[model samples]
Target: MTRASSQSDPFRLRAWIKVLAVGQLSYASAVAAADLAVPHPIAEGSNYTDWSGGYIGLQGSASGAYGDYAFSRTTVGGRAVPSFMSGDGTGRRDQGTTATTIVGGAFGGYNWQTGPWVYGVEADLSASNLKRPLPSTITGFGYEDADAFNIIRAKTDVFGSLRARLGYSFERYLVYGAFGLSGTNARFIGNYPDIDTGALNVAKHEVSFIGFNIGAGVQYAITESLALGLDYRYLDFGNSRRFSLGSVPGDAGGPVGTQANFNAHQLFLRLMWFPGGLRVPPDPAEIAPHDPDDGNSDRYSLHGQTTLIAQGTPGFRSPYVGDNSLIPHQARQTTTATIFLGLKVTDTTELYYNPEFSQGFGLSGTHGVAGFVNGEAQKAGAPYPRLRSNRYYIKQTINLGGETEDVPDGPNQVATRRDVNRITLLAGKFALGDFFDGNIYAHDPRVDFFNWSLWGSSAWDFPANLPGFTQGVYAEYNQAKFAVRAAATQVPKEQNSDVLDPRVFERAGLNAEFEGRYVLPWLDQSGKLRLGVFSNVGNVANNREIVTLTQLGIFDDINTAAVVTSKPRRKTGGYVNLEQALTPDLGLFARASLNDGRTTSLSFTDIDQSFSGGLSLKGTAWDRPGDTVGLGAAMNGLSPSHRAAFAAGYYGLLVGDGQLRYGTERAVETYYAINLTKFVTLTFDYQFVNNPNYNRDRGPAHFFASRLHADF
Candidate 1:
């Protein structure tokens, strides 16, 4: 019998999803009513608009699945099956388990309308985290004098549907019903201990199935090109056949087989766009004149972007190797696509969601250097494409009655006018970098610098999960010349782990920053200075303790020692970020950050201190105003205790050679971005690292990269 880790709880995940749902709906009601207040004026005296075109949309959904896991029979070579598996002739069985989760995805279809009737075909694909644990029946079996038990788990990660729809139009609203074929990729995993040796035996079976689906919904045309809708869908996957739970040839029990039926119900809020949509030109007199400084004033906005990066390194020196060392010559690539969806509930309120697809890995699985290359590469990299909801948050602004300024339309932001002095509150899941760090010259990896240290404060150790996001609340008070921002968030449960710690009061992250803007005294150019501080309390181990444990022979190595010695400890740090505009086409940015380095690093790289500076220049000199060139360098260092741990073969979150020749890791990076069009850009990047992984004997490595990016 194997035990599940106590730190992980499914209820916590469900609880957060529930919080997100309640928060969204509570505010969405206001939006629904507000949407009806201003109706589009009828054009050409027509009561209906054309609904004939191809459309695509993004959706956020809540889904539940009921699964019957009753096992009908069991066979294991010549060995007698366990009582639980064989049902013991007593007919004792587990009825079922229900799984619920929040999901996000993309959909597209074509619609045709004639008079009051409309018809269409649609298809959608979504990623899921629907999972539930199953209760195991007593088998009346013994393993080495200990009672034996089993653990059963059921989960679904991906699902989709193809359907045909029919609807009736009522002016701007359309009510529809749909029937479709649906399928899900599911899994049933089992854990059993060896009856004699008490060793663990694992088995997993793919439990995917096809099903029939039915749904209905209503949509309202908010604009000629945009629509908002709500839908409910039901899917029934009939009983499945008995299948093996996987086993090797020489196992005591041959294999386990089980049968089950699955069914699901899903509710969705969809925002769609119609391509080549028919438009009723508004009366010229009713239209407002465009103002360049006023920016875009749309009720809602949609934007998307995709980035692909391929990087390689040339041969470098390496006298020895450790568990996490970069190879001399290597190549790797990563690709990502994201859709930014936003809705303005009111003049002061907005909701946003970003669904993303990612694949590929960083070189050497994102290790070998403290100041690593490839900012786009996630620590939890995947070889195959995976879809995930990266960000979904609500932003509310309270005006203090001052001069108004225009806010530009961009990803996660809708164009509007805001008070010069206002208080903004954000709640939900998002990356800390989105709001805290403001460096126009070196921030964004897709368009500017590509090295991790250059693009962000590497020593901050901000709270985040595997993909670098966290659920939390953030607030900012902005004035004409200064801004103050703060956030409290959940930290990862373990070092570089995707699971977040549920003990918010005891294990959380807090961050704050003060930004001041001013003009240079002599140059008369604008410059900004930002001071940031962060403190994290979590289950992290101190480097000194791990080193001590190793010295006493209580632990054989640093990796194992750190895990065993972990306790609730505090890690605090601060940073200075500065950016200056040298000219209209040239800018300079720099950052210096440091952490206590007493405990092991948690969410980010292992650098205890780092300094990076960069220069960004537009290609106006060459008459290519849309092009850019960047150059940056970073120096990363570790605290004395951290250095001692590394010298003693103590592994860090990243970077650790079996032995250490300590050195301040230094790297220089440069990139050139060529804007092929307003929506597309191609960039070439290169970086050189000295003393990779802080090991002086290891390398003076060189890296080259090519990136392609598109957005609209």
Candidate 2:
């Protein structure tokens, strides 16, 4: 192609331009028409929060539940006691009752997304303090108005769930259905004015059971890997199972609790995060299950305690009541060492063994004072060190259900979590005090009050050999606010010896205790009341019979009547102890006990009726937070038969004199303990006695002691 001259090319240019314009116009029209016919896909799909990933989330919910609970006395010998049997819903709360509570927990799950379909599994656990009030007026537990429990309270402690989710995704929103298993823990507590020893009898239980959970949820994506979800769920846990007569939930062959339907409903607002998200999930096998709930750490722990006490009395002597007299100017010392070994065999089983060594002497060999001063001091002893396998036992716990308590590692305790409502079975050797007649403020002499009368009921004479060791079996039914315990122990071969009888059926000790625990928030206080009854079948002399023989000049000593009479008789008694925490730094405790005084003195001191009270105060009030001061008093009285036998110049093992001018033995004791460190304590104690050993002729005297204790 050649161009002509400029003037001549103008005509040719115009012709070329016309052709180019027509071509451009036709192409523009085609592009405009095609744009109308087809448009670009929306960007909503790309912005959706990817569901194909694992996520951990926090969930909060409003929950309500309904159930039935029956409060009846636990059974003994396969039969319910008449006093405790509540056949008429006397202290029961029925179904159709509701309570509202808030719950929060962490949940983790992984989702698999295939096109519009999504599937996932999740697990969660939560805790709550939920309560409801019920109307109930129950009486006759004890023979006092204060013994009645008029108000009933129900509480829920914890819950958990494992769920599988299926959903349909619509771009940025999902609608899902959830199916899973769920469980809850709860209990019922009864209380009123008298509720003495209510700590043992309060209908407190921890019950744990499984149920089916079904729910639906809707979620909205907020980012590529985050979403907000709202869910509604229903749990059908079935009935709250009945506990055994002892309110034991899982005792073999125990009675099932009264049939009671139980269930819950909840609504949750949840925030979720899907890390490592994708639009489409990889192979199912490639998904790793993330579990973080089972890393509680094995609890291997140790504990030990040692106590040394040195006591002295200044020039105090007795003439008449030699058998029960405190000798003149005596100085005594006691040393106790114990090592506790605990093994957690399983989730619900524990084995504990305590090897204890004791070396000590009490004032006048621990005879004069009916209300013994030293709890660790035994009557019969070889001043040389005595080694006793004080506590060797296996405890198996079965949970029924309710709130869970994390049990820290300690002596005779396994480190784990457990339902509050449970049954505990123990067998082997242990102290009767370990299972019965426990007073929170006065129980442990190594730490708290140390007077024997303040430590235990003087008149009950709980069965034991020297050093308070016995072979026996015990069953405990526990709940949130109360507990019931029963035990069968072998009595000593002799009345007050340190040997278990080879024939258990011939000389046995059976005991039952009911306890109640209460927290008074208004007064910032907590209290425990315990009621226990104990019976011992052993060779014993009747004081009345011995006295009759002495009146006829037929008895040289009370022991002669025991040899002439038939085999030993059954001796029974009961005690009630109450301990209250007035404040975080102050406590009050009291105990009253009575026993048939017809029997001669046995394993414990001689007192037919005993009363004791005390107060303990921490030094926080005086800005000395580690110091504690305590003051206590005890009164011991003898039965008419016992007094008469003593009056006739007949001596017994302890507490009998050449001549008897019977008067109640009264003692007042005070102690101040200085805490030098977390594990060490030094205490100074003093006691004043009036009419020691019930003998009016003995001079009132003063006893003093210094105690040093170390524990870990």
Candidate 3:
């Protein structure tokens, strides 16, 4: 669990202002629309509003599903593609599971009313991405004699409904039931890794499914053209058969059939717009206040964020492609779903867990620059779908006595009151970046800057295992004006690996930070400054040592040295981070850091020194308040000793150009996010990278990205 952030007074004031402003706007709209209410000819003198017109709206739904799949596999002949020989050991099987999730989309409809009865037709487009993936073992695509694990994932991307509705009108409300024809576009992906051949295989296919839907709903009119409603819908998409052709040596197909089936039941909230439609007689005493985030007032709540990103770079100059060089003109897409689960164990204690599922690869497999573009994409892109626990922890908060303030509800946070002065203790497995190097304007890639260098002080060399997580215990003391924090974490046994050293006491990393927060006197807005220091003792290989050994013909290369080094190394670094809110709609952030230049990067990427700065602007000026745009730039430099290694044709995981003309790697990134609806956003991003792989001889690269994100 994470402690509630103690925000400055100015920040709290800004939040309340925004909330009140939005409420006022909604109320004003309701009042005006009431005056334009349409009357029902068939229900004259009745209290109910007329329900006869065309309407369009948006909705958010929570759905629970129950389903099953019975798929069969068969091989065509004794010899086809010789890699996988199905039927020899594997055959038909049944797979099933159940879960609940949420979906959001738009709906449009038309209705005709006669007396107290109403008839209509409606259509909607919605999406759901939460489900379990199936796992299998096979041999074929990559090799015949070796068995390997194969993971298969399938999803119903966008499902649409065309329904016929029938309803009976009440004094000021309506009750209706609907049945409809539904269609869905489904996608299937299979990944198999052959241990014998040391390679991975990926297979993909897409198909459309037609189904039926039935549901019931109730609605009440707030004004003539605007109404509030609740709906329940159930959908059944029947089986879709799949067939495959032989691949490699052992992959054969002979009447091999796989069927995909799915069903769902949803309860949704609807906001409808029916211009020149009907309205109910005003009943002030019966009007209920609208609370959008219903469960947010509770001590225990849930939140989630999912994003799908697709990126590509038009061919750039790459005279040669080394192990880590970015491939020109290549494109890739990735999707991630994270569930935030939190529980309040006591008034002063909380527990939280995060589980994530990710699919897709980064551009050129997350290579080319030491300051990689996608912070969410690690080198761990697998041939199959993956599920991992991102975080699990407990937090304790103790009041030291001071002013009391309310903490707003959000992911990993509870709606409660806390003292201005407090001490927080946290222990568990989590990402160091989550607590140490945080920035209001650039920290989370899901909503802010997507580049690693911009989100964190690149040169700090924070100790993190692969997936950017670490195990540790930390303590923080906070006052109205300042905060002090310290943490001790275990380092990974090897570079970028998930395994931590067992003898943690002998190979540990330490971090300490001092934070000073205040409001700019003239601006009357919040701003923060954090200065931090980090030190680590671990058995890691350094660039200088690898280069020296290669020069003496005692080692093959730097990559090889990382696997065998048992010598302990000491590394220390310091960083300065600042964030300032110039206005409610504008903010600025900057970070600069320098490390001891003498040791290996052990965890993150290859920069020993770095500087990054950026400004973020909210879309209030354009009247699209939920949208945002950001502009940022960063510069990364290798230490003298490390530079010597790269200059000698040695390499790190993300960079090594096969030759040398060392220069500082620089990057500039900008993105604009447009909120399509309250729950969905589309972002366009571009980045220009200079001195790819830290080699002056290599290209300046240009990357383009389109991102779609939805949250519940």
> How far out, in Å, is residue 171 in model 3?
25
List, residue by residue over 499-555, the lDDT tens digit for candidate 3: 877667788999999999999999999999999999987777766777777778787
What lDDT does model 1 reach?
0.75
Which regions in candidate 3 have their CA more than 4 angstroms from the true location? 1-297
Q: Using TM-score, rank the candidates from best to worst.
A: 3, 1, 2
- Give each model a TM-score: 0.63, 0.58, 0.65
Candidate 3 residue 16 C-alpha distance from true site, Å: 43
Candidate 2's C-alpha runs over 4 A off are: 1-299
lDDT of 2 at 342: 83
Per-residue lDDT of 1-712 in model 2, one digit per residue for the tens? Answer: 0111122454334323322222222222223322111122323434233476688777654221223334444343354533221122111112212243445567898888776778999898866644555433322233234323233456777878999999986545677999999988766554333333334333555667689999877665444455555566777887556653233222222332332345665555466666654342232223433222234343444676766565656544455334455654544556566778887777788888898766545666666677777665666443334567888888899999888777766677757788899999999999888877777667777776666778888888777887777888999999889999999988877777777787887888898999999998898788989999988898777778877775677866555765676366888999999989988888899999999887876677778899999898989978889888988999989889877877766555556555778899998988888775455566777888888778887758787666656565
lDDT of each: 0.75, 0.66, 0.69
Q: To one decimal, what is the Cα RMSD in angstroms of model 2 from the true structure? A: 35.8
The sequence of per-residue lDDT tens digits that candidate 1 reaches over residues 583-620 is: 88999999999999998999889999999998999999
